[model samples]
Each structure stands twice: as structure tokens, then as C-alpha cells.
Target: MITQLRVDDRLIHGQVALVWTKELNTPGIVVANDNAATNQMVQMTLKMATPTGKKLLIRSIDDAITVFNNPKASDMRLFVLTNSVTDALNIAKAVPNIEGINVANVGRFAENANESTQLSSTIMLTDSELDSLKELATLEVPVFSQVVPSNAQTPITALLKGIK
Candidate 1:
């Protein structure tokens, strides 16, 4: 069954391969990113990053959704990864059954202006990404930011509370 959906700029890396794998206990990992899916080097890197013996599938957003929905893909605990808030919103909208998204990391954006509040050293959200996150928060799905299971979850509501 599809379990956790994560929004992390670095999809499938050291922390995800080790920490999240152990935390979620999900053997199946699916990374849905257009750029990563099409890039052979990126795909190879993700495959190598996956924990030993766990299954990893990197596909475009649509195909990744199909993989999760397929009956043949059952029998596995799956964690879905996306690099952008927009992409996470799209996945959540396309597949209503997706549990929820964990906002792990958004990274700095070239377009980020002075208005963008730096949530962490790695995450800096621009207006567009923040707006998408706001919309996701309105959905029935839960939206919260936490780099790892150990860190306290910062709900989207709390972060957006004082912001215009």
C-alpha cells in the first residue's frame, strides 16, 4: 500500500535511503520527477542511493501514479517522493488515495525574493512554491514540514500564520 509522500528537493539520497527507510519501514520507494526520470545519470544515482535489497522505481509523475494504482504493484509498502510542492500537489490531486505529504526540503530558489522566509538552511520557499503549499494545506491531505522523523513537525498552518 502507498504509505508516505515526501516533498524533498533531493529525492532519494543518503537520509532517505537510510533514515526514512528505517523510519517508515517501507521497502518500496517511488520517485516521481520529470527531470530525474529522463536523466540516465540521475536515475542511476537514485538506484544506487536506494537501500540494499529495497525496490526503487523512478518514473514520470503520471507513470509513477499508475505504478501505485496497479493491482500488480500491491504487496509492498511504498513511499512516494517529489522534489517540488507543485509536483506533490499534482500527485495528491491525481491520486486521491495518497496518504499525505511530508515536507522535507525545498532548497533555495533563484527566484526567491526578500519576502521568502528561510525555514531552514536548505529550504527557502518562493511565492509560487509557498502558494502551492498553501493550497495543499487547504486540501484534506495533511501538510507539514519536518526534515526527519526526529525533528518536530511544523504544520503549514503555523508557518503560514503570520505571513501575508
Candidate 2:
């Protein structure tokens, strides 16, 4: 069901509605953020960002795991987006079947340079986050960083090495 799991701070935005959705052929967009789940205003903002006719679900990380684990999820091309590496790590720990995580726009709030690898205008990194990403990689989950459809991706490992 989940064709792609991405870590993007912006969640559903222009690049997501216009580019990644079409590139991945995703019919459903799932935003897994605890904060967004409880806030009606933020939820409405996220819903407005999505393209018309596409199914959008904004839920907490736990609910996302449940939905992703369900058999019905297999029928839809799902795109899961989280705002932080910690959230991504949490989901991966809860759902071991998820094989990969794509690192997209991490935004301007990220601190701790050692935890993540800076990729572009919308990307940043910190060491603990990078370590968590490595844990996912050890489980055979490939972590990739790409801004948009046309940008080149750099593996998290390579970025880590460059940081060191």
C-alpha cells in the first residue's frame, strides 16, 4: 500500500501535489504527524494543499502504522510523509515491513549538524537523526535525499561520510 515513505517538513505542498505524486503514481497521501493530527486548522491547511480528487489522510504515527499494516492499504498507492527523522524512525520501528524512507524537505528548524546531512535549500541534518537513519539502512531500508522530481539523489551514507 505504501509505495513511498518520505521525510518532508512541508508535508503536502507544491512539490508533493504537483511532482512527487505524479512521479510515484500515488492516489493517497498520508501525513503522519502527531501535532497535525490534533490541530484542526493545520489539518485544514494540509488538506487544502492537496490536489483535488486525491484521497488525503492526516493522522498520528500510530494510526498510520495501523493503516499501513492493514490489508486494504495494499490496494492504494500510498505516500507517507513525516516532518522529522525521529518520526520516521518511530514508524519504521513500529512497522518493520516498511523497506525504505525518502528524505525530502526537512525545512529550517532542524538543528544538530551531526544528526542529518544537508542536501539543499529545503534539507538539513543532525548526527542522532543520521544514526537513526543508519539503523533503518541496516534493516535494508535505503535512505535517499532528493528535493524534487528532477533533482539527483544522494544516499544518506554518502552524505554522512561527507559530514565526517
Candidate 3:
């Protein structure tokens, strides 16, 4: 079962490695990103950022979804990470056990930042990304933004308010 699907551009970092993982109490951490799965450098950095004793798996988005659907996966608590809302949405649509989605950090490194919509201090989305997020909000699972364990989980619908 997935405790949460976090959308963090940094993938695994201090806030995620130390705070969210411990708070979610998920022993397995899966990074569902095609770029991270094939890039040795990115994979190495993610592995280094992972907390000690926790299991980390880096796989392409499709592969991660397959793992999520495997019967054995339901027996373990997993916290999944994706760099974009679209990827998280894809997982949530395919994996019914996700608890929630945290649209944390995004758009900082996006090439089209000039045309992005600012949802929060930590969240900015381009037009295409914003469309995907809107679709994501319509899913059955809960979707919110909470940068750390202490922050209140702000519903993605609330953030989408007044934005066409």
C-alpha cells in the first residue's frame, strides 16, 4: 500500500528523507520517474539522500505502476515519489491503495517558468502541467500540498480555486 505520492522536483532531499518518510512510517521508498530510472547520476543522488535502513527503488513510471499492482506490494507500506503531477496522477489512477498525493515542490527548474501558475510558495505549474493537475484533482484519492510533516495539508482543489 502506498502511504502517499509526493510530487517533489528534488525527488529525495532533506525534507523528504528526514521528515516525510519518518512521518509516513513507510519502509519502502519508490521513485517513479523515467529520467531517474535511467540516469545513473540521478539514481546515485537519490540513493544517497534516502534515509538509512529504508528501502529505495528507482523505476520508470510504468514499471513502478506494475510494482504497485503486484499482490505482494499490498503487504508493505510504500511511500512513492514523482517529480511531476502528471506522473503522480498516472500512478494514482492505476494504483488504488494510495493514501494521498502531496504536490510539494515543482517548476523551480522548469524551462517554461515564465508561463507558469503559482499555486503556493513551493508549487508552480506550466499550462500543460496545470491541466494535468486539474485532471489529477478529479481522481478518487485525496490530493494536497504539504511541504513537511508539520504543514497543514492544503487540498489541491483549494489551490486550484479561481484559476481557469
Candidate 4:
């Protein structure tokens, strides 16, 4: 089962490779991004970032969903990562055992930052991303933003309030 699906543009990094893996006690790390899955260099970097002794799997969104739904997957604790809100939404819709969806970091490096909405220090969402996030908020699973294990979980709904 997925302990959490984190939306981080950097995919795997110090905060994620070290803090989150230990915090969630998830030994299996899955990167569910289309770009990362097909890119050899990206996969290498993500693999290097993975904590030693923990397992890592890089798959496209659809392939990751297939892996998540496999009966054997229920026996393990997995932490999934996606680069965009849309990808996270797609996974959440197809998987039933996700504990939460963390909109940790996104749009920080987006070219259209000027047109995006600033939801938090780490989250800047483009118009299309915001639409996906609104839909994500309506899902049964908990959807929130918590940059690290130390930060409090801020519900996506709260951040969406008052925004046009």
C-alpha cells in the first residue's frame, strides 16, 4: 500500500530521500512520472538519491497504477512520487490504498510562473494545475501539503479557499 503520494518537481532529493522515507517508514520508493521513466539520466539520478537498503521503482503513471493494484503490492509499504498534480490525481483515482497525497512542491521551476497561483512557499500552480488540484481536493483520500515530516499537514482545501 502507498503511504503517501508526494508531488515534488525534483522527484527525489535530500528532503525526500532522507527525511520522508524514514518518516513514513516506506522502504519502497516509486517515481511515477512519464519523463523520468523514459529518461536514462533522470532514472540514474533518482536511483542515486534513493536511500541505501530501500527499494526504488521508476514507472510511468499507468504502469505505476498497475504495480500499485497488484495483489502482492498490498504486502509492502510504498512511497510514490509524481511531478504534477495531474499525475497524482490519476494515480489516486486508480489506486484505493493510498494514505494521503502531499502536494509538497511544484511549479517552482515552471516557465509560466508569472501566470500561476502562489498557494504556498513551495507550491505555485498554473491554471491547469490548479484545476487538477481542485478536483484532487474532492477525492476521498486526504490531500494536503507538508514540505517535510516536521511541517504540519495543510489541507489543499484550506489553501484553495478564497482563490479565484
lDDT of each: 0.81, 0.78, 0.93, 0.95
TM-score of each: 0.89, 0.86, 0.98, 0.98
How many backbone clashes does every candidate have?
0, 7, 0, 0
Q: List the lowest-lDDT window of 10 residues for candidate 4.
A: 18-27
lDDT of 2 by residue, 10-123 (tens): 888899998888998878899999999999999999999998878999999999889888887767778899998778888877765554588777745755544545656666
Model 4 C-alpha lDDT per residue in residues 67-110, reported as the tens digit of each score: 99999999899999999999999999999999999999999999
lDDT of 3 at 111: 88
For model 2, the stretches where C-alpha displacement exceeds 4 angstroms are 96-99, 111-121, 162-164
TM-score of 3: 0.98
Expressed as tens digits, the lDDT of each residue in 38-113 for candidate 3 is 9999999999999999999999999999999999999999999999988988898899998888899998789887
Q: What is the C-alpha RMSD of each candidate to the true structure, in Å?
A: 2.0, 2.5, 0.7, 0.7
Q: Tell how far residue 95 is off in model 4, in angstroms.
A: 0.6
2: Cα error in model 1, Å: 2.5
Model 3 C-alpha lDDT versus the unseen true structure: 0.93
Off by over 4 Å in 1: 73-75, 109-115, 120-122
lDDT of 1 by residue, 16-57 (tens): 998988998887899999999899999998988999988888
Error of 3 at 56 (Å): 0.4
